[model samples]
Target: MAALQTRALSKSYGSRLAVDRLDLEVERAELFGFLGPNGAGKTTTIRMALGLIAPTNGSVEILGLDVRRHRSEVLPRVGALVESPALYGYLSGRDNLRVIGSQLGRVSEKRIDEVLEIVGLKGRDRDRVRTYSMGMKQRLGLGIALLNNPELLILDEPANGLDPAGIVEMRDLLRNLAAEGKTVFISSHVLSEVQQICTRVAIINHGRLVRLAPVAELLQDGGEFEVKVDQPDELVAALKRQQWGGEARSEDGLVITAAPDGRGRSLIKFLVDNGFTPDAVSARHRDLEEIFLTLTEDPVK
Candidate 1:
């Protein structure tokens, strides 16, 4: 069964539609990425899924239970840290966990320690949250989310305020959580981070889903091959015979993406057979930033 599923889920505020006919499915133990620019309905969709707001149309299911009707049963199994970390300034890190723990019913100190260690806050658990750095506070928020050992975790921009080192730590932690069979749904504007950490991704733009696919496939579509040859014109001409030829260009002894398959060796061999000796060949996959720009830059009609 899918860990989470939504069918034509939509939300509208007055005349403006925040989310429109959004359909998505997250499999068990999968790290799913929800990506979009600001005001693209990513947050709105998440809010609806968490029952923080009602959808004007469609429905949501968590663990195969209807979100609206079975929230009591579903919510307990889900952990979420949306937008900012919610922490009491005066409460110590461990005390904050204690407070949340009380609501969840007598959580043991050992479990709190386990979560603190998982988020790399074991040593600072006794410090007041106000004294913590942004990254530390983020980890503490994550610890609170993990306090219940939830099956599904929804993190929105969990790396928003972190420096490079903190981002790396957060990435590793998410991977560890998924390895333990927990389903993670992460929403972020940082495309590179999502690409590195998620197995599959869904892109939303202007309140609509633009694309959803495996990370590899998405990169493959936008991949480019670099072919360095003695005769650029001949290689360019040869590539022009293929379907993707029109998309290829020649630049400074290098032929870029001018062939059906963006493979360098075949182009070099083609050149060698045709009386040209190519120096080097390489394949370059599109980075997450490029792919994201291509998908989101075009306006949603």
Candidate 2:
């Protein structure tokens, strides 16, 4: 079953449309990345899915429950940390978790400790949040969200304030959560991070759905093979003679889409027979950044 789905969902404010006829589905236990640029309606779509805001049209479903009709029933099983971390500065990390846990009924102190540890804050649980670093505060916010042991976790830019080490830790924590059967839906403008962490991705541009697919498949479509040869002109000529169409340019190398049926080896052999030795032959997959820039370069009407 899909953990979350949006069916032709749209949101508008007066004359401005934020999200437009968006359709997406995230499989159970999958880490689905939602990627878009600023003003691409990523946050608006997230708010609609969480029932934090009403959609102007269409519907959102969480675990088969309609977000609009069953928000109370659906929300409790989901945890979310959107945009920035909101925490009480005066409260210690442990106290913050305790406060959130209290609202979810009587949660034990042990459970709080477990969540703190999961976020790599076990040793700093007693420290006041004001003394915590930005990354630490972010982790604490995540801990608060996890207090109820939610089945679905939605995080928007979870790595925003994290350092390199902290980002790695956050990635591991997310992976572990998914391993434990939790569905993770994350929104990030950091395409490289999303490419590294998410198994599947849904891209949005100009408030409309662009594509949704496995990360590998998405990369495959944009995959290009770079071939550098000593005789660039001759290589281009030979390739054109054989009707092997590709974009050949001077300066660096020739970039061509990978053969559909894995005939790259044959192409290399053809190059060798034509007296051109390729200096480097490498397969390049488009990262999230490349895909985002390409897709969002022009506004959708």
Candidate of highest lDDT: 1
Candidate 2 per-residue C-alpha lDDT over 88-121 given as tens digits, one digit per residue, 9 for 90 to 100: 8999999988888777788899899889888999
| TM-scores of all predicted structures | 0.91, 0.91
**How far off is residue 266 in model 2, in Å?**
4.1
By summed lDDT, the worst window of 10 consecutive residues in model 2 runs over: 253-262
What is candidate 2's local distance difference test score?
A: 0.85
Q: Where in model 2 is the C-alpha error above 4 Å?
A: 240-246, 250-262, 277-280, 299-301
Error of 1 at 133 (Å): 1.4
**Which lDDT value does model 1 have at 284?**
60
User: What is model 2's C-alpha RMSD?
Assistant: 2.3
lDDT of every model, 2 decimals: 0.87, 0.85
Candidate 1 lDDT for residue 217:
87
Error of 1 at 151 (Å): 0.5
- Show model 1 residue runs off by greater than 4 Å: 237-244, 251-253, 260-269
TM-score of 1: 0.91
